[model samples]
Structures are given as structure tokens and as C-alpha cells.
Target: MDSSSPASASPPPATAETGRHAYRPKLRWQPDVEEYFAAAYGRDRFALISEALAHPSCYSCIRVNTLKSSTDAVMHKLMDIVSENGLSVGINGLDIGDQNSGSNTHEGNSMVHKCPYTGLENVIFVRGSGPHVLQYDSQPEQSVKEVIVSRKCAESVLRGAQVYVPGVLACSAHVERGDKVAVSVAVEQAVEDGGWAVDAHYEERKGLYIGQGITAMSRAGIFHVPHGIAVEMTERVYQLPSFNGTDILYAESFAS
Candidate 1:
């Protein structure tokens, strides 16, 4: 029953045609925490982490293990490897702006995928694209056959994690393997008193949008199995596009 695997490979390069500004709800920070930070530091410092947490991550940070390999040796090896692999790799110091539009568009869609930035000998930061529109023939808002994952999983998905089997709390009936499905995050109260968890039978109210993914396991396999990825997230509205072929040592670093 362990047929499910994770989402691999960034789609083809993407454009920066982001149209995600409409009715975007802001996730506000708690008042007490904000006040505490403001008192300790200032209003400006208080908002830094809170603001970053609210938005989807636009980059994947990789701090290379300096003990394992020298930074110079790794950087040289990376340059040759990227050129041989047919992806344009630009090494920027702190200049992470105005990336050419052609490089970022993957799967024939649009988002910003910038070149790798190495600000220090051990620190390498690679950028990811989006909050891109999950372009699919969207089903009705009250559509059937939805897969509901817990809040924790939703947070990971916001940060570019695939839908693991253990995170799946419920799924609609007869959901076949490899089906393209809409994913939702269950609200806090979906779990009732006595610590009983929500199941497929519960009349779940509409939940928040994460995005769409391909079903790696059928509905039965998802519930019955204890481990593995339940869905390979394909199109996430809160996109964190992977940087593999172009980013330095990214293949070996992010290899699962």
C-alpha cells in the first residue's frame, strides 16, 4: 500500500506573470507577541519575523557543510556541473534582483526563479517562485472528492513540502490514485471533544485553499497505510518552486 511518493522536479522555467493580488487575506500576528517584541526592540523589529511567516517563502536557503567540503572546491565543481546540465547558473553576491523572465517560467507557467546567491563561504541561498496561480480546471467551491489535511501539513505545504500520508486526516469517497484533486486544511474545531479526529464521513465545512496535487494513493490506501506521501503536490497557490538543475549542488543537496 506504500505506492505514494513525493513531488520531485521543478516544472519547466516560468515567467513572472503573477496575478495573485486579488482579495488576498493577510494572516495577522497575535497582539501579545507583537507587543512583547515591540517593547523589547521596536515596532519595526517586531514586524520582521511576523511578516516573513505570513508570506510564502520565496527562496530555499542552503548552508553548505564546510567540514564536508571546502567552499572553493564546491563552487568550482558547481559551475561546471550547471553548464553541462544545460541550465544558466548565475552566481550573485548580494545582487538578487531583476532576473530575466525567460529563466523562471516552468511548466509553461510564470513565477520568479532566480540564480543562486552565496553571501558567505558556507551560506548559499537559492530563490523559489510564487504564490503562483494553481492553474487547473477548478472544481466548484463545494466540490466533492476533496482531501483534507491537518493544519501542520498545510504550513509545510506553504513552505514547499509534499503531502505526506501521515498528514492526511480525511478524503472523499472513491478517490482514485493519480487523480488531480483539490487540497484543503481542516479548521481547528474539525477535531471534536474527547480528542476524536475528523474522518471522511464528517460534513466538513469549506476550509482554506492550499492548492492542488496529484493523488499518489487511493482513498483506501491513504487511510489504511501508516506512512509515505499521500499526494504529490503539483500546483500550489502558495508556491515554493524548487531550484535544482540551476542552483549549485542543489541536486545532491535536495535529493530525497
Candidate 2:
């Protein structure tokens, strides 16, 4: 699906060339197929479904390797990881470790919790929050280094994946290791040459700000390397706990 800006309250203005309405999330479906679904599910319902599918799941599920570790052990390790990452172990105002008191619990937010079901003691749930209001151009006087990634990469980043070299399409001039960069995506678009292009030319690019990260490689290194992580994401528009370097826990599944 074409990822329209999730933070935008409305779509961008119509294009002057085509004079068509603004882009909408349609999963790049054929006209007839989209029409069929719209008719079957009603236009409004189909639109809702398309928008929802473009976003990531709200929570990630980590099924503990019970043979190697206990649930409490895994939980404490996750808390430690959160602390190492500089993320709050608290939900709302309550600490993640304090489960005894319900007074400070946030209604819709949870840092982490063990599965409440009878048979799923080893299942741990990590809650995520999304559609955060990001201040992209907060410092107008300072030039922000930018990295443009593929749409697929941007989507994966929203789901808590780091930016890899292969996914990087463009990087700002002078971008070097340790540089903080604004990460965006270069969505595919038709070209006059009867081909599609995903090149990232800042002003011409139609994309959304997914997150910010510190560069692991210089601009030259990113394009030259065959494969490796390019950017280490520090802040994401949709916040999710990444399980990349965890020892005994991995995101076994996602809860829609």
C-alpha cells in the first residue's frame, strides 16, 4: 500500500499536473479490484481497512524459551534492556516492575506484561504506542542531516526494525558516522521514461518522516557496503520495543 503520511490530519494538496484528488491508501490495487472490495465492504469500511493495514501492530509478543529461562527471569531482563536503551520502564506514571498496585496504571498503555491466560505463562507482551507527534523541523536555523530509505524500510522501522544499508537510497551530503539524521522514505512513482523510480531528491520526494537515528556509516560507506546496519534508530514515530540484541527473548509473534 502507498504509505500516506499517518501524522497528517488530511492528505496533501492535489497535484497540479494530473489535477486528481490527493493520494489515498489503496494497497496499489487494480481499479476493478479496489472497486469490488469497496462495493462489498462499503467504501468507508474499505478505506478504514486500508489505512489500518498500512500501520504496524500495536503490541509484540515474545514467547519465552521455557527450557532456557523462566518468565520472571525473562521479564527482568527485558526491563534491563529497556533501561539500557534509555526507555522508561514505566507506563504512564507506574514503574514496570510494580505490578502490585493498580492505582497508577494507564488505561491503554502497558510497558510489558506476562500473558494473563492459564496456559501462556511463557508468553510476554510488549506494548507499543503510535502516531506520535514528531517535531521534524524544530530547529529551523540548523540544517538537519537526512537519510532517505525505501518505503519497505520505513514500514519496517515503524514496526521496530533498524535501517540497513541496502534499504538506504540516499543520504545527505557530509553524512558521517555518529551523525543524527532524520529518516524518511522514497515511495515509488511513475516516471516519464515508462519506468518507476524510487530516487530520493528531498524536495521532489513524496514520503513521510518515520523516525530519527544515529548513522553507523558515512554516506559513501552506506552505498558501498553489501550489507550491514546503516542507522541505529533512537526515536521512532511509532514507539515499539526492539528485540534485536536480547539474549533469551525474541519477538515470536505480533498481536494485531
Candidate 3:
């Protein structure tokens, strides 16, 4: 399947405002046009685009500012709260260890980790694993900045935005001189070919995965840089060194 496709077309016009903006349905093309989109991109792309147009565009997950806390801590705390309150949750298989431990001999574990949230950013604690942040809350008193990291970067670390050299596609044309901007992942659709699936469900897909970094180079210079972090996410939302600090405290207390 060809990975490249044209960008999404312009959305429909907004409705007349009556005090506040009134909701309006997106423009629907004729059946033939709809069929063409489905055939070209596949069903998932169609649904994702439709959803984006229908609602305020939102990414699937948000990475937390890890400088404030570590992902392990946030995840642990999130799980503890959930279990204590008796909540049922479904976690993606990738987040935990492998589902097929009996048959698969691979010693390594799955890469992803799933944590539940009571609300958007409130994380419950899990035993031994440590504390985790459930959601990112607005800190009006404290200045918080965000940036988009590609799924490529997110796969490296679950929280915060630490963009690598290769993942950056295009930065805001005007972004320059350490301007703080919210980073979002670039969304793309997977294509299918014949009976074979080009994009496997297990294979990680590209989208906004984390938020991090400052603009060290101009949009022109990004393509030129060969190494180093593109964006430095001081505050990550996933597992990081902060957990070690918590562990040290626990150890010291126990020793005493």
C-alpha cells in the first residue's frame, strides 16, 4: 500500500453565530466521492477524518510533563487509585507484558505501558511500580509549555515531548527564537494493498505521540542537523528518572 496520500481537504464553513458559535454538520459529498475516498485511503482513514471534522480535533493521548513527575510514578499512582476505588479498565496488550507467555519464548517484554485515569489527568498509584500522573492539568499559576512529538519519538518515551532529529516534518513556518508552542503529531492514514496488510496492528503508527523540546534550529536547519534532540521535553508525562528518586526515598526510609 502506498503510504503517501494527499492532505485532508478543507473543512466546510462555520455556521452563523448566535451569541456563541452554533454547531453545523460537515459538508457531505455525493456517494461517488465518498466511495473514492474509502477506496483510496481505506476505512480507518475515512473514520479518523470524519471524527476530526465532526468534533474539535483531538489526538488519542496526551503526554504529561515529566520534569514535574515521572511516568512510572504517574502510572503507579493511577493504578492504585483505580484499584482502590474498584474501577474496571481495559489496557492495550502492548502496554503490559506479552499476552502469550506460554508459547512465545522471547525473553523481552512488551514496550507499552497502560495506566488508568479517574479524570483527564488524575493518576492512581500502583504498588511497587511507583506513582504516575493520570492527566495534564492546567497550571494557571505556573507556566506550562507543550509541543508535538511524532509517534516515533513517543515510542522512545511515553511522556513529554522529546523530538529527535528525523521525526520533524515541518515546524510552524514562523516559529523561531525559542517560542513556546504546543506540539502535536502529524496524523496520517494507512493504506492497504491486495490481501496483504501493509500496516500491521502491532506495528506502531505515526501521529502526535509526545510533546517536548525547543527550536534550536530554524525550519531550514532541522533538515540539516544530523544528531541531538530536536526538542527537549523537560516535563514528560511518562516513565522517567523521577521514579528512581521516589525509589531512593523508599529505600532510605526502609533502611533507617
- The lDDT for every candidate, in the order shown, is 0.52, 0.67, 0.37
**What local lDDT score does residue 67 receive in model 3, on the 0 to 100 scale?**
65
Residue 64 displacement (Å), model 3: 27
Which digits, one per residue and each the tens of the lDDT, describe model 2 over residues 22-111? 122235566799999999999999988888886677677888888888878887777666566555545565565464364433222356
For each candidate, what TM-score against the reference? 0.55, 0.74, 0.33
lDDT of 3 by residue, 156-238 (tens): 43322245556554454444546544344433333464232222121121222243446665554555666555565443333
Cα error of candidate 3 at position 66, Å: 28
What shift in Å separates residue 143 of candidate 2 from its native position after superposition? 3.9
lDDT of 1 by residue, 54-109 (tens): 56555554555566675555544443433342323333422112244443322111
Give candidate 1 regions above 4 Å deviation.
1-52, 70-119, 136-144, 187-207, 241-256
- Per-residue lDDT, model 2, residue 155, is 67
Q: Candidate 2 overall Cα lDDT vs. reference? A: 0.67
Model 3: weakest 10-residue lDDT segment is 247-256
Residue 185 local lDDT, model 1: 63
Q: Is candidate 2 or 3 superior in TM-score?
A: 2
